[model samples]
Target: MDEVSKNNVIDFDKEINLLRSRECFNETGFLLLRGIITQEKIKKLRSRLEIIFDGSSRLSASIFDFVAEDNFLSLVSNEKINRVLKQLLGKSLRIYPNLTARKATFSPWHVDDAFSGNKVVNNESNSQFIQVSMFLQDNHYKYGGGIDVIPKSHLEETWQIQEQSLSESLEIFRRVRNKSVNIDSVAGDVVIWDGRLLHRSSPKLTEGGVDKYSLMWTVSSIQSNHKEFLTHLENRGKLKESIENRLYDARYQELTHIKRSDFSNFFLEKIKKLDINLTLKDSS
Candidate 1:
């Protein structure tokens, strides 16, 4: 083939892969990028995370935006993560304040969009909001623990999706569980999911083993969906007065979804626009 033709094929292939990744996420509302970070990076972050936990009782299994140190913040700027995010959230991806670190925590089946079943039906422009989670262990039967998701279940919305009983949610899950996926990821793997997707913590199949450690953050391109989800989060946060008016609040609070996405963006955005300290700490 001619030099020009060869170059064209290579460029075309690259463009196609980019489009395919975003297309898949639009349909499924989640993307699992295998080994997106190095194991060494995961180890360092895990060590620091362990220190942050300071050997607290395993009973809690979570820390709310505990630390925004540089190492934890750098994961978001990882090249592979940026690439996928650019495809999904456009070039203007703005991260919401707060980073959450967790160890072996579990949450029941739920949606982050105010528990609304159909508010996020349109995954086009509204797909700007996404959660990026990095797991520090292999998700296998023996190792156990990962996230389970309902495929395409994010494409619906109601002002509020009534909470379902465990048995009831399970019954519904059982009916369409075949269409869902339990992300079987490994250490250093990254899972980026839409805010509206129905998901829950995958259980540890074995009785004993080191627990899983994960770091998560939320980012979004300006879109209408952000407004809806934020309103839902703020109201829930106010229910328990979990909303922290401070830029870098450190209290443990459960305000629906990941507490990182808990505050109203109006609140976060106001702080962000001021070029306050909420932006990622420069790793440079």
Candidate 2:
């Protein structure tokens, strides 16, 4: 695709509005919210990040939720995303704890079957989840990097080539690359794609290049199967924490602070109003 159609990308506050932005996500499997976050908030986050990080990339991103920092939470819960999410998902939204912060990193081609027990995730026909990512700096082909995705790829059955042979994966990639396109965005933009969509970081990984700071998190519609969803979490936790050979540990261990007891009255009440499920103990 040369450029995403107007229907797939919308201004954060443009008055000439569509009746519902949710339709875009359903049809295209992704939506770009232009300038969803202001520069002020992005600047604040960068400053705080400078203090907390030592110029190294890490996968344990649960620190973003620390009540002490409160920097990332402010962005995650902003009204722009909440409104879009509420409209796409129902009034209630359940955000998974699988958030990640990456710096100048590139990922291989794959689909996100996050929290699912096994790799045979073939249920994208009615997907109710999305991966939300926002970059701290501009993402482009010239100066920096961004995501490239196969639009509507969710409609096709996926083959987790990482589990299969390289020859088979190469054959599949030859075809998959025919449909992929680079997605460019600025610091304040938010990019959301369906959980089943085939996507990857663009321009490949380099030795030394512009830093691509991105924060990614997942969200689910409350109407999804809760029991199965909980099981997915259980499997994800055990598989990673137990699996010796792993690139990054599962996020469950880093989410202990989400227990209702850990949240103060102020944030607890706020979280309650957002209908964010504090699933640590199922109480709160």
Candidate 3:
């Protein structure tokens, strides 16, 4: 690997061992890795992502589903991440779709594995699933964005301890919360967590809006009946296409589904407007 790649990929054995021994990751069920990417890489990735987001129409849910793109593939194919996956899951790690590229926001408390059964953590002999969230900017106090996770909530024993209503108001959930930590992270930090951990986006507590750009990747062991999980993700992608059709002009579809038609003009127009907005904001 190149020097840049080597620097970006942390030593899996050392970090993982430290995390486990300290119970920093095991107890909290999440690990926040700072400086996973250098500033140069973040700037380049952000620029490429802005192009994708603008041309494809940010409103189109499928705008995030660009796994085949070089930028997205580069993240998944990172040597360090692959090694970690091999150690934690197995030899084969399958990347799931709908890789998120957007401003992070508040969310209701829930477990990702609540929908699809957790394959990695529960399986004894096979690979498992883990999520890596790459925050592109600082999300801390007053910014009103970050993750709030219930400690050790990934354990089955912890699940049994709660009969809490998932429908309760955000404040109620906050008040009654136990040992939940707000994961305020900085740009280039990567947060790795088990899929079963109970997490929610920290509520927007202030009126001052700040963009919390982030990238998310979900990976599972190939032996973990991942075909079923992939199918679910594929269906979600289709759902995004359907939603886009209903809400947007048909011309915009060509920007992403390039084979459908030529959308150069539309793409150019969208990106130009995006450039104008950025320039104006910077000037201001």
Candidate 4:
């Protein structure tokens, strides 16, 4: 590796060791680090992201739709971010093509693995998934829609609290709220957490509305059975065949019946407006 790559690897190792020892995430279900990315890089990324969001109508509709945009995936393909992810997750990581949400969007409190029949156990080995959110703008508690995490919630074995009704969930949030840390991040600050942790986006309370731009990515260990997991995404009409073919090779054949025609015109139009070239090079 070159100097920059070498330095990043070293730094990543340090962060990984720190992450393992601190228990900060277990205690809070989140951790924050400042200056993770240079100011210049954040400016460039924000510029590109803003153009995409400006043209894409989906961003205003719902957080799920906004996150499924192709341009958002293109943005997260950044090498610097991927390097850190590789160190934390391993080289066989597969990134989900989702960006979490922008302003006015809120993710309900739940665990990603809940649908898979896995409960949040005390051992990390039972945690099958991880999520990382890279903030491209400054987020504050007053801004609302900021992420609220239940510290050490991932260690709980049951979904007793998470299964409650919305009102009940909010009441639980109010009671066990150890620390409601607003992820006030300037561009490039990344927050990594266990997927089983109980997390919800606090409502956006900004005046006249404010756009909270963020890049969210998930990573799973190699043994996490991504093929089966990806099949689930594909069946849900979330994965494109073109990328799926490349990622899964012959495995795509098994899922041929699940493929759907690409209908993400809005997502593609935003990419064109941003002027970011996205032609995939031939692997052969």
- Which stretches of candidate 2 lie above 4 Å from their native place? 16-20, 55-57, 64-67, 115-125, 142-144, 161-171, 204-209, 244-246, 250-252, 256-258, 263-266, 281-284
**TM-scores of the models, in the given order?**
0.71, 0.82, 0.65, 0.60
lDDT of 4 by residue, 1-284 (tens): 00111111123324444444234444444455444566777676566556656765443323334434554544455454545444445555544433344434455666554322443223445444568776665655566534666656667534454334678766755766664444444456666666766666655665644466666656655556555555454443333344443222222233333211231555445444533222211101
Candidate 3, residues 1-284: lDDT per residue as tens digits? 00111222343334544324224444445666654567888887767666656645443224324434556545655555555555555565555433556554455676664232443246222225677877776666676445666656666332321223555535545644766667766666676777767777766677776455667767765555555555544444455467734334222233223321222344324323322111110121
In model 1, which regions exceed 4 Å deviation? 1-16, 58-67, 115-126, 156-164, 225-228, 241-284
Q: Return the top candidate by TM-score.
A: 2
lDDT of 3 at 217: 65
**Stretches of model 3 off by over 4 angstroms after superposition:** 1-27, 55-65, 113-127, 157-166, 169-176, 235-284
* lDDT of every predicted structure (CA atoms): 0.59, 0.64, 0.52, 0.49
In lDDT terms, which candidate is top? 2
TM-score of 4: 0.60
Q: Which of candidates 2 and 4 is the stronger one according to TM-score?
A: 2
Model 1, 1-284: lDDT tens digits are: 00111211112223346676677788777877764666788788778767867767542333344433546656655556766777777755566433577777655566664435445335444475688888888776565556777757667533233345678667666766666667776787787788777777776666776667887777766443555555554554464364443222232234233433434455445434432223222211
lDDT of 2 by residue, 1-284 (tens): 45666777768677525445567677767877886777898887766665555653454444334444446655566667777777777788776545556555566567755423333332744557778888787776654556877787766655454433456646666888778767767787888887778776665443454456777777777665544555565566676677673456435555533554544566557667888664442422
Rank ordering of all candidates by TM-score, starting from the highest: 2, 1, 3, 4
